[model samples]
Target chain A: MSAPLHDLTLAEASAAIARRRLSPVEYLDALRARFEALEPRLNTTILPLWEAARAEAQKAARRIARSGPRSPLDGLPVGLKDIIDLAGHPTTCHSRHLLGNVKAADAAVVARLRAAGAVFPAKLATHEFAIGGPAFDLPFPPARNPWNTAHHPGGSSSGSGSAVAAGILPAALGTDTGGSVRHPASHCGIVGMKATYGLVSRRGVFPLAFTLDHVGPLTRDVASNALLLGAMAGHDPQDPGSVVRRAENYRRHLRKGLKGLSIGFVRHFHETDQPATEEVAAALEAAARLMAREGAKVKPVTLPSLTDFAAVNRVILTSEAASIHGRWLREAPEGYSALTRKRLLPGLFVRAEDYVQAQRRRRELVAAVEAAFAGVDLLLTASSMDPACRIDDAEAVEATYSRQARTPFNVTGHPALTLMCGLSKAEGLPLSLQLVGRYFDEATIYRAAAAYERAAPWAALRPAL
Target chain B: MNEDEAAARAPGLGEAWRARAEEVAEAAAQARMMAQGFRAPADETAEPMPAFAVPAPARAVR
Candidate 1:
């Protein structure tokens, strides 16, 4: 017997829809049934657009019957993090302050996805304003890891990770500012990419930090992630950060093997910098060995300490986030969750000289990374220091925030992809590897990640939920 | 600035908000220290990093 519709990857479902073997409506129904059964426990979505999505799926089905698929994303049911605006729909950002925040127009990325004929079934949950999260006091409960529902799924793209992993949807939109996309992808065991800073437009998405925020995709597989990124990419004049680079066929290099590729293993980032768990350390070593065995040249490349990157990132992130939330934080300080308030309020204390200094440090760090990339095509590092822990553990959550090596790229504006590498022996939760490429070079990053995914056994495993 | 002095000197900040800012004081200080390392020898002549500027739209034919 064939696998269930919900079990199929986004690419598989898109092909099935195009072949007429599975109608868009049928696929939506399968996902709806799965969502109904699992959503309560996972809390992945804040607003489930059931009837509207069914209507759209029916429209897509008719279009497929009359013509062919509009794009690779056609008829694929996907979720958007609540931070993205959908015209005539509310984007609550999982905060009480923005509960009435409805958009008059779709976000640039959402508009592109709509043009591609992708079906939007829900707005996934997120950390309140995509910064502070896993808190009990929020407009919606934080998303739980499907691997072990009690454990954290990482954030601020919490729901995007959980929804894709739970198979409620094959793919979803996520925004990464300081490893939000990769963190959940790491903890949830999926593929997430923070495309080059300007590759995807941020217009209409709620901003946490304009200079640091990135819109990306979370998918169960690298191929699907590539497909989603291709659809979402392009320059938007409205988004100041959007670049004018020509659109790339992200899937063009997916099948290219790792032979002749050079990989830089950033051991010190995890070992001496933040110090990953033995399981994570072993996973990193195993991943490097697999790449070397696959004909890729793997070498250790050293950069500045993780503390330097984290310090620079936090300074810029906190300062900018404070400026954005200044009004609400000052007028209605009670509107934000305690954690969000705590995390964001610190920016208020940052001196102007300090913000400038952080920017200067950021430039130096970017130069250091570029220098490292000169000798290697990609840099590999741990997505998180350890596996997912119980969501209720406050101390663990605080430590995990500073434990990730994913934020360095956010500071450098380089493209990064995180994919499952192994499962922790103790918790059986996913451990992830992050691949960093030069700015606007996601094609190469995806090439390396796809090669790694092909050789790794982790992608074959899925949550029982 | 020390935590107490920074809080007391803060503009229009409430006691609770001041306490919250104090929580990340060490992090702010670390970032500041890193920034100092980026200073060029002739720092006064260096240009400050510019904020992101919106791109101008293409002009339509008259």
Candidate 2:
């Protein structure tokens, strides 16, 4: 039997397209059929660009046949989180207030994807304004986890996670602020990376928290994540947060393995600081052993406590969000979902002194991460406290919101990534392991994660949709 | 400040929005306290707060 088109990773499909074994049009057609069958149940896409995407695919097929692939991303179908503008498409952001908002120009990332000959087939769902969700009260429904439809897929890049995991798209762009991209990636059983802050331009992506927000990629595997990030990364003069740095081939060192490298196992972050389930803890311990077996010197290392990071992250996020939305809150108070209202309101009460103190603490946290990096090349920890819980359980969702070990990277402006490590013993969902790297060190992060993907038993498993 | 007082102090966030805004403020207050707890005193002459700066570009030979 032939391998299914939808099952091909971005790397797989791109190679096939380049070799003339697979046509871009054929690949997109297969994915479109899958999306049609599974989308209603998954609610992963808020806007489907069926005709436009088909035309683009056909165009790409012709180009590939005439010449060759444009880049590693050529002819691959990718989803854009609704918060990303796509030049004339609605950037709804899953909010009622922005239902009429349409893009005047493509977001920097979207334009880059187009230049790479990738097809944008849909606008994936996001938390309202990228901060207020899994909210049912929004204009669109929250995406369900494909592993089990009743479970949450994480958010606010909720749809990007589900779509990639469900094979509707091999890769998608997601924004991470306080773990939006990594959270969804963990729950959806995919690879997501929030590379060093300011590495990817945030000019066209909607803001959640200016300093905290990061544009990232969600892919079914580590190699594809690397390819997608490579395509979208470049400094933009328009984005003040963007940094001018030499571009990197993120996949250049994927096979370097873990030999002669120091991997820091942040056990206390999961074991004591936030306390994960037995299954999650076991999975992390096994991951450490697997890395050690792969010839990496895995050892315990400590940074600031998880509480310190979360406190600093929340204060900064809320204060910035409050400042951004204060006008809207006063003008259209009822337009927002109740949860978002609650989440953003706290920002209003943050005293100026508190915001300044958080900024100062943020500096210290950054210094701590830098210090930790002096001893270890990479840091490993639990992605979440446990497997995904029921999407409908409001209290459970609220409880788990701040229970992850991801916010510390955002606070400190380092690269962080999450990938499946094992299956949850209690809930049968994917348990994830997080890897953190020093600023602008995504190649090392990819190298280590690719090694884990090869050694870990979880990579071959897929959600039975 | 308490929620009620916070809402009242703001010009537009009045009675109907008071309770919700207050709840948000309370959450913010808790986070504030938490941030405060993580604070460690620095030296009397510690350098000024960190700020973002533009990197100086390389210059051409005269």
Candidate 3:
């Protein structure tokens, strides 16, 4: 049991610690030993809160020893996206801009996690600035994919994906403005969710596009994602956009299958709009078929072209992004990476009429999707145009980032999830399917995704490192 | 010339999609005007951007 304790997941290790089956000190020690060994090869974490982590772990053990009240995350250690602020630790955003800008207070998300008693092992790597990245010109090297260090582990949640998949942390806090969270989760073969636009607060997070940015989780399974999300989901009267949804036990419907469910597929998005590789297509089709066999009313449905989501997302994202960083761009233009500076430079060209028209169109677009969902419980597509690419292919998450996959949901402001569908038999890389739910209907979407996850055999296969 | 100081000084959606908010909102409004079926940009690639632009971010208030 001790031989490979280093590789056991947070979920697996927790039960042992909770029952006094494993010492928190020993578990953490083993984790640190492995973290040290893995760090040189993986290059995933930065500014590990080792001293703070040990102190927290010790406190948790004292509580478990003295009394029995334990927070769900009582003795767990978690990795956080570098963009989220951790008091006293530099919220670097993996860029030189914030190198010495040590946060004076934890971002709401980190504060909440610590309140739940989880250890902050470290701040993990991210694509520089979260919007355009995988850039190495910044303070840290981009995280390598654990499956194949030479391959791409998607960004801007690059480090979160690598850290979690490499078993360096139980779960991680990652932000998804575009497909950042889900893309990495898919490429790294983990579970990731971008909750409804305002379901979680973005306060204290470095802004990319205020409207589209979301703080979410990338975990090894739905259960762990649920635990982390539960602790972090709540109203922050501080964030103007955060909605007032009751905190949900995100894991409630996991055991339920797709009985009496309507799952629709958007095939053209996968096949034509941003054509997926053959293996990706097959993996998606197989998942759909399996759901159908399990009594889901699965059918192909259509929405506007993938091109529309791309255009709208771009205008809105860029326009908002430009506004947020304009001061920074104007003053410290040289501070940002060539990738971000270039990607954002285009926003400088958006006209006022264009911005307003995009918003009005957004209203119409949201209405269109609302109508589309009237006939289905959820919609599906390929998470990415292809499986993991070489991490070195390009620094811009936008390069191969297709208009087909996630942008539409971004336009409609709905909750979307991505799960590993199956391993590409040809390349041994993972393939994933996307599920978008009615705005705020993540529960049903999770039910459908969780049903498929259990019924299919994909979750059992880890990437060969 | 920036949004806060311009004609597009927004009232709703506040600071949220500022420039694009105005552009997309107006694009929908204009498409309505031109009879060019300017449905919102949902999931489609945008038409190459109109050769125009949003005003800059506001200058600091003295």
Better of 1 and 3 by lDDT: 1
lDDT of 3 by residue, A151-193 (tens): 8888888889988887777688899877788888988998889
Q: What DockQ number belongs to candidate 3?
A: 0.05
Could you tell me every candidate's TM-score relative to the true structure?
0.93, 0.95, 0.86
lDDT of 1 by residue, A359-436 (tens): 766777777887897888889998899999899998999888789999899888888999998998877899999998
In the predicted model 1, the residue pairs found to clash are none
- In angstroms, give how far residue A226 of model 3 lies from its true place: 1.7
Per-prediction DockQ scores? Answer: 0.16, 0.21, 0.05
All candidates' chain B TM-scores are 0.35, 0.38, 0.27
Better of 2 and 3 by lDDT: 2
Judging by DockQ against the true structure, name the best candidate.
2
Docking class of 2: incorrect
Error of 1 at A57 (Å): 0.8
Please state the error at residue A237 of candidate 1 in Å. 0.6
Task: List model 1's recovered fraction of native interface contacts, to 2 decimals.
Answer: 0.15
Candidate 1 residue runs with Cα over 4 Å from true position: B1-9, B14-45, B53-62
Best by TM-score: 2
Candidate 2 Cα outliers beyond 4 Å, as residue runs:
B1-6, B15-37, B40-62
lDDT string for model 2 (A319-373, tens) is 8888888888766778999888878876766777767777777777877887888
